[model samples]
Target: MRILSGMRPTGKLHIGHLVGALENWVRLQEEGNECFYFVADWHALTTHYDDVSRLKEYTRDLVRGFLACGIDPEKSVVFVQSGVKEHAELALLFSMIVSVSRLERIPTYKEIKKELNYKDLSTAGFLIYPVLQAADILIYKAEGVPVGEDQVYHIELTREIARRFNHLYAEVFPEPDAILSRVPKLPGTDGRKMSKSYGNIINLEISEIELERTILRMMTDPARVRRTDPGNPENCPVWRYHQAFDISEEESKWVWEGCTTAKIGCVDCKRLLLKNMKKKLIPIWENFSRIDEDPRYVDDVILEGTKRAREVARQTMEEVRKAMNLMF
Candidate 1:
């Protein structure tokens, strides 16, 4: 399957990113599927256009995160979205075919507008991002898009756009399907959705000491105010981490029995969870350290991948032009 997915270079990636998306991406690439992963720099502009001083820095960190998490550049095409100009051209062409009402109806667009109400999100670019996303997937003629549940609607819209384009012009693009991730969303330390804005994220580049402190401070079952009080693991955010990190069956059973029976205190449970998490995250941090030190290596990877992506994108644009009678 030709799979494509991307992430905005808004800030440093967090543990939520590692398990929620990066792990899944690495699994897909290892499964022998063709993958195209790009940093959505243009998409970042939809929200962070006001201050772009750190845009290049964030982009570099994002690529580092990708490589550190085992997204092998040799196996997958990793590039920047704006590096290939075809994405902008395709998005412009798609805008004419898609309705303003359709874009307005997208749940994410409405949700983001509310979430970032402080920001001036009244721009046309902010509203039509889904159209650009469609261009991102369709430009590569991707058969499947690896996305979380929140993004399934965007893939649906992409399919609609593909169908419309084919109906109006010619069959040049595939109606891509959403390959839903099996992993559930990882929560922030504060037990809410992990977001940079929340300031509750555990970034991938966090120090071991900070990781320990963060995990130790994670929110637990609110009902259990005293150490003597029995706790429900279901309501405890630490327990959720244990589950996400794949704590062994024996250890999991111990945690469940202990939490419900008041045999284990929240601190001890958190300590155990911390140990298990470190085993998984330490290697990724090490990989990131080596990659971060070598900026040239990161540049070479992006340069090569962008060139390769442009080759495929150019061919797609040619077919699109011929279908729409834009070719001279």
Candidate 2:
């Protein structure tokens, strides 16, 4: 099946990114699927339009990081979303078919605006961003979109757009389904959500020692006042990491028991987490460290992927124009 996935450029990736998506990308790329992965630079602008200075650097870093994490550009098509001007052009075309109310109904839109504390929700591009997302999927004729539950709403809108186009024009697109990833959980240093804005993220490039130090600061059961205090693992962030990373069922059970019995302090639990995280991230870091040295590699990869993506996009747009009679 054709799988479509992407990550926005954020300078360097982190454990949250891995647990959230990159690990899943690696698995799917290896699963013999035609994966179309792109750096969603445009989407980054939706949130960070004020900070355009780091975009190019972040874009390059994202490409390199994905390469380092075993997303072989050879096996999958990797490109930048804005490389082809057609994405924006098609986004405009799709905007006409979707309603403002529909865009408002996107659950994440309000959540993002409130979370980001934006000065205004007035950016036209920001509000209707899902239309651009639809154009991205439909352009690739993607059979499935590999995403987390958070993005299910966006893909649903994409399906609606595809359905609308088919009903208005011809049977030109497929209704893509959300291929939810069997993703692992990756938390931040503070044991909250791993986000760049939070400054609690363990970047993919940081040393193992740094990874350990970050884990050490993670929040635990507040009820556990002292090391001797028995705590509930259910409320500990460190325990959450164990649930995601600890492979041995016995080990996890031990964590639960130790925490519930106050045998292990949150510090020890965090130390254990850092050790396991290093085991997972060290190899990816090693593979991707030299990626930036290749000056032409990112450009070449984007050019090739864009070439193929544009071909598919052109085919779709041809039908769209013919159906809408743009050229007749």
Best by lDDT: 1
Q: What lDDT tens digits, residue by residue, belong to model 2 across residues 223-246?
A: 899889999877777776776664
What TM-score number comes out for model 2?
A: 0.94
lDDT of 2 at 305: 86
Q: Pick the candidate with the highest TM-score.
A: 1
Q: How accurate is candidate 1 locally (lDDT)?
A: 0.92
Where is model 1 poorest over a 10-residue stretch in terms of lDDT?
Answer: 179-188
Error of 1 at 231 (Å): 1.5
Q: What lDDT does each candidate get?
A: 0.92, 0.82
Model 1 residue 276 lDDT score: 89
Model 1 TM: 0.97
lDDT of 2: 0.82
For candidate 1, the per-residue lDDT at 84 reads 97
The positional error of residue 307 in candidate 1, measured at the CA in angstroms, is 0.5
Please, what is the TM-score per model? 0.97, 0.94
